[model samples]
Target: MEENDVLVTVEGLSKKFCKDLKTSLWYGIKDLISNIQGNKNERLLRPKEFWAVKDISFELRRGECLGLIGHNGAGKSTLLKILNGLLMPDAGKVTIKGRVGALIELGAGFNPILSGRENIYNNGAVLGFTKQEINSKLEDIIDFAEIREFIDMPVQNYSSGMKVRLGFAVAAQMEPDVLIIDEVLAVGDLGFIMKCFKTIDNLLDNTAIIYVSHNMPTVSRLCDKIILMEKGQSLFQGNQVGKAIDMYYGSFVENESNIVFTNGSIELLTIDLLSSLKMNDNIHEIKWKDDLLLYFKFKLNLYIDIPIFRVLLYDKEQRPLAIFEPNYDENLLKNNNGFLEFTIKHEGIQLSKGIYSINVTAFKRNSNEPILRINNVLSFQIIHDEDHFQPFLLSSTFSTK
Candidate 1:
């Protein structure tokens, strides 16, 4: 990419905030005075102050999308604010070449008392659009937002979904050189969100986008590059979008199982993943089509006639993917001195390349009541040469005429 092709450039950007309101105001006054005296040191942190965003740098060119992803309070929002010029950085600089459209927060640039139509024009004007330009796009915005009936109502009366629809429609329809979108699209309906994504796809060749989202699937679908943030710092930044997403999910893994519901009748003793490649003490690595073997040991407090066992698999986002249940007649649970041991074997697993977790449930024969239900008993990563967003990677043959 050439130098002029880079529409947005951020270098060594940093911002800090004081935890205490009174102290923040006092420090603000002191900093203003020090700046007047030409003796201010923005790099040093004062008492009760911490960096909300620190030393973050990236360049965005036309026809590319950059994704910012992290947990709440990880400074993703703070970085967007800085990029949209809503907050001033204590250090570093940002350079942009053309008009910028942003929808960082719900109802951010709109007046509550104003109607939706008025706010649309107001936002367009802020983006340097004249009356004729706004007029040409007015019907398109209303149609895209699907709020033709509610366009004349005050913005305060709009629901969260309505506000998001209108906000995104205006920001995306403006066709600005650079677009900054936060997580506001999460509030819109699925159909509307799909429409917004299509619009983004259409705009990608002419616009540079900075997108912040918690939905990994959408981020994976749209972003060409990814930045993972943690505690006001960049944990990972590069074109490896899949790896960055994996790292984001890895940060949330729990060390121990979460018992959802358990009766006094059974106690889980030990659960282990029978894999040759162990990523850590807890996570195992398996090939794409290899068999998945799990061993379990349980202590029965109160004996039942027949016990049923169920094993479920979940993706990185905790969505249930597959389930395994053994035939009651084939595999009988034998108890020796109130202790039972069994193994569940899944032949020819077809999971794609990603992290997965195991969930277990036990119940009495022909009963809906559960003796034990636990989540995240064991976690594993499937290894493959290529990454896929789908849960399963089935073998198929392709032909063309």
Candidate 2:
């Protein structure tokens, strides 16, 4: 990876923002006045100003994919905007070597009143493609978007999913030197997303990619390097993508407070972890081969028929790792006036040697409303005997409850 192969570079990048919209607008006006009055040293920020991203630096080389993972409002989007030239950095510089294609937001660079067909040509033109060049790839774009029937319809009339399909298709087909994709691509169906990934994989030979997402598995699959963002800055960036993703999830889980939901009839009281694989009855740590049992206790204030218990497994970072549920007796909800205890048992645990957490909830099957939801109710550490350098894979199955 020589410096000449570099497609993107950032130096001392910083962006600041105001929580108040009025304050931001006023600041903008003040800066404009100061610029007009020949004052380059305008106030960096007035009251309530904070850096969205501060002193971030990174580089992307040809044929490399950099993943950005962070929680909402963590400045991932803000940094992407700066890279895509949608927003300017308050300080520092970004250098790009080639044409940039981005799927940053829904209908981001499209005109609402223009038809999809027209927008295709418009985007191509913006990329300096002649009418003939656009016309040649036009069918492939429409075919990939799967919107040929509605290609002539105005973009404003398209559904959100349809717009996503078109946006990703155009950006992928352009095959620019640098491609930026945000989470909006997830708005498409699974099949479409798979197709998009295939296209991205094909582009990996030459195009540099900056992928922003909360999906760790996808990051593991696509990124050559990973960046964990916090408060608009790069908290961590390294080739250890898996560990970086774990940290990203950890940041989210650590900030969450344990509070029981009480609006519904049934409320969860406590959750316990038990195992039969070892002599210890109640334990917070488990071996890789252990049989684990989840003990759930909840109380009912009103009758709720056919309540469904949903259990979500998360890695140390609180990112959703898996979900397991067992069948329960329907008769238990008949009275719904007394406390209930249930056990969910599992065997053949296949997971990496690290800390994992659980989030369990109960709700009526008929409605999506939750009777009770708990986030990171309890955490357990998994001890394994495998070599630490080996790849981590967790495979487990639930036994009959």
**Which candidate wins on TM-score?**
1
Per-residue CA lDDT of model 2 for 62-147, tens digit only, reads 99999998889888888999999988778889999888888765445689899999998877666557888788889998999999
TM-score of each: 0.90, 0.74
Give the whole-model CA lDDT for all candidates, comma-separated: 0.85, 0.77
Q: Which stretches of candidate 2 lie over 4 Å from their true place?
A: 1-4, 33-45, 106-114, 254-270, 274-283, 293-348, 353-377, 383-401
- Candidate 1 weakest lDDT stretch, 10 residues: 325-334
Q: Tell me the tens digit of each residue's lDDT in model 1 across 328-376.
A: 7634767878998888888878898988998988878776578889999
Clash pairs of candidate 2? Answer: 249-317, 250-317, 350-394, 350-395, 351-394
- CA lDDT for candidate 1: 0.85
Query: Hey, what RMSD does candidate 1 come out at?
Result: 2.6
Error of 1 at 246 (Å): 1.6
Error of 1 at 379 (Å): 0.9
* Candidate whose lDDT is highest: 1
